[model samples]
Target chain A: MLSIVKRILGQMKNDKRSLGLLLFAPLLVLTLLFFILSDSSYVPKLAVYDMSEKFVAELENHATVSEETEKPEAADYLEDNEIDALIWSDSAGTHIELLEKNSKSAVALEAIQDTNKALQPTQKELIIDYVYESTGDNQLDSLSFVFLGVISFFFVFILSGMSFVRERFGQTLERMLMTPIRRIDVIGGYTLGYGLLAAVQSVVIILYAVYVLQLQVEGSVALCTLVMILMAFSAVSVGALVSIFANNELQLVQFIPVIIIPQIFFSGLIPIDTIPFGLGNLCYLTPIYYGCTALEMIMIQGKGVVEIWPWLAGSVVFIGVLFLANVTALKKYRRL
Target chain B: MKIEVCEVNKSFKQQQVLNQISLTIAGGRIFCLLGASGSGKTTLLRIMMGAIPADGGSVTVGGIAVPNRQLLAEMGYMPQNEALYEELSAWENLKFFAGLQRQSRKTFAADAEALLEIVDMAACKNKLIRDCSGGMKKRISLAVALIHKPKLLVLDEPTVGVDPVLRRKIWLYLRQLRNEGTTIVVTTHVMDEVTQCDDAALLRNGHIIARDTVKNLIAQTPDGNIEELFFIDNQSEAEAPLC
Candidate 1:
């Protein structure tokens, strides 16, 4: 088993491309996700004309209010894209003209509405609270936790799955079986070797997400990394087990839709409790669900290992079951 | 170490591969199993290696039962296909398999170099298996099987696609190993190569039609051509009479 680990790591050292993919693929995707999913603080620039100083001051809290001395200049500002919207009041009522028909325009309109509410002294202020104490970045922070679990699981699964399938195709598995090595050692060696790589991958991704991309984690980074490492091990074990049924690399790829994509759905894509028809219960069956849930607890909800041990325990159990399945699957090749 | 197979039966999906097959192979000799493709030669070899379970009966090597893990420590196998890590160099592949057999690093370097020299793969030791030619891969596979210096060596078609000169060299090396008390089992369709074996067995439709010393088996046919025995209408003429 130790020899197997040495050989696998040696092969990895030789193949620079796979090593690069293993370490950097998730980081690249996460960086892209950081850019795409992260919300930017977009403060709409509003051009107000014929508005009271007090009302304009209130609008400044919600938007960047710009005073317009000429009503005709409103068209110039809106056309030039310098202002998101133009607000003016007359004898009819207040009117707001939006520049572009996009999300920025909607933000400007929301700012205007907020300003109007502030002006109404008779209305009571509304206070909305979250059970988990969410800030403005909560949505992206929570989504990053899911991606942290899902993306690391995905790259490890495909790489390790393909590597094992190639081993079968090359007949090395058969050759290895002819030796005195036990079947369990083969699975264990592969897990330890590939699992080591996966652990490094998880650490790099988590560090890049937290320190570089500024992903806010309420709990200890070490604890979140532990969950991610467990998640990565599950991927390696499950990849090996699944490759047993695949005759070739293409056949292994076919399993992504069957085995991997469904896990993504259960990995916090849709709110588990909100999925119609009690399908949320299916999350327990997918390995990624436990990882994502545990990460959510640690990174978002600030829960410690004491509160999240069940999810961690669940991940360990899932990895153990799949590792045993991989060992049993070797029976098809060698009875011993 | 001697190998004994008795009444071994194996089938795949109701398709009978081996039926009540029995044989004995003495130690320190080269024993060849001769057959056409799909004649259960590979299956019988696999059964002997404990790679697949026999449906009935048993096989034993040196008093140890078949499929025994400890027994494998003393055995080496070279599959028909060149089963090698394509991404690794020939030397790395040798080290990996040698490591599995627990060959100590103190002597492995010399042993690996000598095996590579014997197989004429010393020049390509640093070349990756994928970059090597088909024949080079075969030679490396042979070297790997010989790396651990096992007591028993099983090779299936080890000479196919090899040049005649190298083939002669390999056969000479096998005889040398045999003389060194290594029990060798080989399966091949090469008629001339069978003459190099101390004993030979011919299988047709999962049954051994003849088993005898190469000299006696050749003399049984009308002419000296051993291939004639395979093409004979009634194979009973070539079968050795039971003691």
Candidate 2:
């Protein structure tokens, strides 16, 4: 074991560039996410034309409302989506013609709803008009977290797995095997090394999505990081195991859709509950299911580690199984 | 210590690679397994190195059975493939192998340099292995195999692709090691290399068709050359097996 540790340290020393990339790549991505995602305030520009004081006040309360002196100016504003909703009253029971510039129609829809409630006391049936999406819900932006979780796991798993496969293909694995090293030593060394890298990556991505990109993360940052690390471990182990079945780089790449896509389907990115029961059971077997579940609990529900331990435990077990599988698979070459 | 193989046989699915092969190698002697490309010489070496188990019979090395961990530590194996990491320098590769063998740091640096010098690669020690030529990579791999200083050295086609001058230098080093009581077992298809061995095992179709000193094998054959004896044995085996 001492020799194994020393060998692992030596490998790290030799491949310093890979080590640096593993540590700092995620930090750089997280910083970019921070700058791009944070401060996403939806200040919808509104245009009001020939509207009563009461109607204008209702629109102003819900959005950044502006008054248009000419019909052409209001038409231009509507065409450009400068005004999310326009209120123009000329005896047609105070018509509230809402114009949406952006597809995120929830805020504009909410503004229309608020205006209708205020007009209700006057016994006037305000006509609500929309240029697009008549029955669209205003909760679409809330789904970004699910996609973020999927993307994070995808990149981490592929990078970790490919790096490991490269080692095997390059014959470095054979060199390590020729030593007096145990099979367990190889698996443990790779897991610890890549696990450290993936953990840092997960933290950077999560923190960037939360603090930098300003995504809606209602849960504890620490819990999120913990869940991310667990997810990273699952990816790293799966990647290592997959490399065993692959003879070369091309074969390793062929596994992406077969191995990774199935995980995405089960990872709660899409509603797997709506699928058939037989197929849904298959989703439960995917590591991404548990990872995405834990991520959702921590990010959306603000769940603590105690609440998310079962999913975390599932990921840990999956990682452990994959690691053991890798060690056993290596026996095809060296028995010990 | 003596290494003995008793009627070992191995097959890959339906294709038999080795058949009823037996030999005994004494310590402080140089033994070469000479054969053609598909003669199973490397397979025999792997069995001795405990990398693969034989389908039939058993092998005992240093009084212990094959695949024993303690025995494995006392034996060094250099595989046919270049196994060092291409991204790392030759020095870095040696450091890693030495560490794995649990060599002391104080001796590791000087010993690694000496081994590189022996391989005529001391000048390119710090260059990335990926940048080195095929011969340089092979030399570094040989140095790594010798890092542990094992009593028994098993080399599988180590001199292939190496220039004639360098090959001779490597053989000279092996001879020096043999003088120091290190038992060397090398596999090669080159007919000329068989003359250098104290004892040679000529394998054909995975069987030890002839096992004796080069002079004895030559005297037994119609032609005096070791290559002629190998061809005669191989041709007879091919015809008999088909019939």
Cα distance off (Å), candidate 1, residue A66: 20
The per-model lDDT (C-alpha) reads: 0.90, 0.75
Chain A TM-score of each candidate structure, as shown? 0.81, 0.67
lDDT tens string, model 2, A1-336?
A: 444445445555667776676556655654554445444467666677777778778767777877778654445667686556666667556555554434545667667677778778777766886432213121322444455556666666776677677767765676577667788987887777767767777777776666655666656887877877887877878888887788787888899989988877787766887777668788768888887888777666667888988988998888888888888988976887
Lowest-sum lDDT 10-residue window in model 2 chain B:
B234-243
Q: What is the C-alpha lDDT profile of model 1 across A1-336, one tens digit per residue?
A: 999888988888888899999999999998888777666689998888999999999999999988878684566778785788999989998888876689889888989889889899689878888777645463567677789999999999998899889888887888899899999999999999999999999999999988988888888899999999999999998899889889889899999999998899899878899988998898999999999999989888999999999999999999999998899999998888
- Expressed as tens digits, the lDDT of each residue in B62-95 for candidate 1 is 9889898888989999999999988799999999
A53 in model 2: Cα distance from truth in Å?
20
Candidate maximizing DockQ? 1
Instruction: Give the DockQ (C-alpha) for candidate 2.
Output: 0.40
In the range B1-243, model 2's lDDT, one tens digit per residue, is 578887788999889998877788888898999888988988888788787889997888887887876676777778888877776789988887787777789999889888998899999999988799999999998998898788999888888888999888999999999999999998888878887788888788787777777678778777668877765623443211110
After superposing candidate 1, which stretches have Cα over 4 Å from the reference?
Answer: A40-125, A131-139, B236-243
Worst 10 residues of 2 chain A by lDDT: A132-141
lDDT of 2 at B78: 84
The DockQ-based CAPRI class assigned to model 1 is medium
Recovered fraction of real interface contacts per model: 0.81, 0.50
TM-score of chain B of each: 0.96, 0.92
